[model samples]
Target: MSPTPEPGLPARVRVHEVGPRDGLQNEKALLPFDVKAEFIHRLAAAGLTTIEATSFVHPKWVPQLADAERLFPLLRDLDGVRLPVLVPNERGLDRALALGAREVAVFASVTESFARANLNRTVDESLAMFTPVIARALDAEVPVRGYLSMCFGDPWEGEVPVDRVVRVARRLIDLGCAELSLGDTIGVATPGQVTALLTALNGAGIPTERLAVHFHDTYGQALANTLTALRHGVTTVDASAGGLGGCPFAKSATGNLATEDLLWMLEGLGIETGVDLDRLTGTSLWLAAHLGRPSPSRTVSALSPKES
Candidate 1:
């Protein structure tokens, strides 16, 4: 409800934890359905209200999440949290609906190359594909979230035009998306680029409150880019705990900005996110132990007493 914080201080950013979905999707060892369920439970126990639980795309694409049908039901949001599952098409929507999902998400890239590689379709094709899916979700009373990847830069497409971004974004919100998340997929965005994009979106009649932001830490620009977006009035932010996410298709790209780091910044800025920073650090630690890798979060790094 309040504005994002200024530089060198806290931010009003609301961090959405994506660890259960993004973090586990790329894992080499597939966790059992129960493990995934418990992971989501612990995330909620830590005071994170928004948790991106799983994707409903076909099993052939991401075999790790093939059990999403089983996973979603197990992690059902019976209370106190919003669990948004990723749905890319009618079939994904059907799967989400069958499992009693209250919210769903769809994605389209800001660049042609990324769109083609990520979804095997052109940008417009991807947007067109979601028409029926969005319609179905709305009909079923399921909230739909739109994810626009590579909002700032694409590895193969070079600099993305602001007009392209605005055009795609306008279409998403127009099509019934409850929220639009601008993603710097390969994390090539600078703070200035973030500001410019958000400014244009605001001028395009897309309220800052309706737009959310997702940033990768590839070049260590995620936090800075997040700051720029917040200052421009964006509130919802997508982050994975312990920095537990990355794009398999994008070369050299790193994880999403860590949830703990974002929470640290938000708490400092006096934003009331209703997230427990200490509990968040604990979840990050538990996850790092499960994954056997160093967490990529600065706040978790400072909080975790475990030897490096």
Candidate 2:
């Protein structure tokens, strides 16, 4: 039975599934191109419209996705789904464009520490690097999405200021990004902080429609924070299938908000995501078997067959 509909929540939510890229990027074992392609196909089969397929970063950086060039062709035939790949810079953007990618996303950091650690450049420097990338992608008619990490708290620099995040977010918007995904990279954000950040962004002229939230489950607040965002009129929520993915750059960060778990909450609240929980859970379980482990998602665990 579904819970009573809330007054302020959005009628529908778009779940941006990030398992293929963000989830597998940090894995110790390298999966074959076929497996990766199958994973994405299965995700699309489960009704995920906007699936982050892979990253175009150099193989030296994220070796797991080195097969990006070969993997993309397999997904070209997937209809009615938006497969957005992550491009770290102009080079990455070039690769993605060459592959006929329809959509792309660039990762940015709001804090200097993570900016240096992850991208080896300061916050402003990283944005400056993305300037040309965003311009070229936009010129080519490819929609660009900006991912701003470390929005709430930074491991090196704790407690990010709302104004600082707003400034960077505005710059990304000004740089021709169609949408901005604010990431709680360390997953330390709570309900109140989520409200504060969304309000701040609104005050700075960034509408809720153009924004998405990507929360990690480090402090076990991913769901609570997501609910806060939904109430604030944010319709796009980022989650990983089976609770896979964390920042390889930020070791302190944990798995992302699980898609099955998020689906459970949304279904219970009478919110529509159009995702088949049973199929998605099965996909996670299949992947978990390939990776030699059980899924970390609570929903998957609860719904999986129990042992005798």
The parts of candidate 1 lying over 4 Å away from their true place are: 1-12
Best-fitting candidate, scored by TM-score: 2
Across residues 34-58, which tens digit of lDDT does each residue of candidate 2 receive? 9999999999999999999999999
- Which candidate leads the pack in lDDT? 2
Worst window of 10 by summed lDDT in candidate 2? 1-10
| Inter-residue clash pairs, candidate 1 | 10-269
Return the TM-score for each candidate structure.
0.93, 0.99
lDDT for model 2, please: 0.94
Error of 1 at 24 (Å): 2.1
Q: Which residue pairs of candidate 2 clash?
A: none
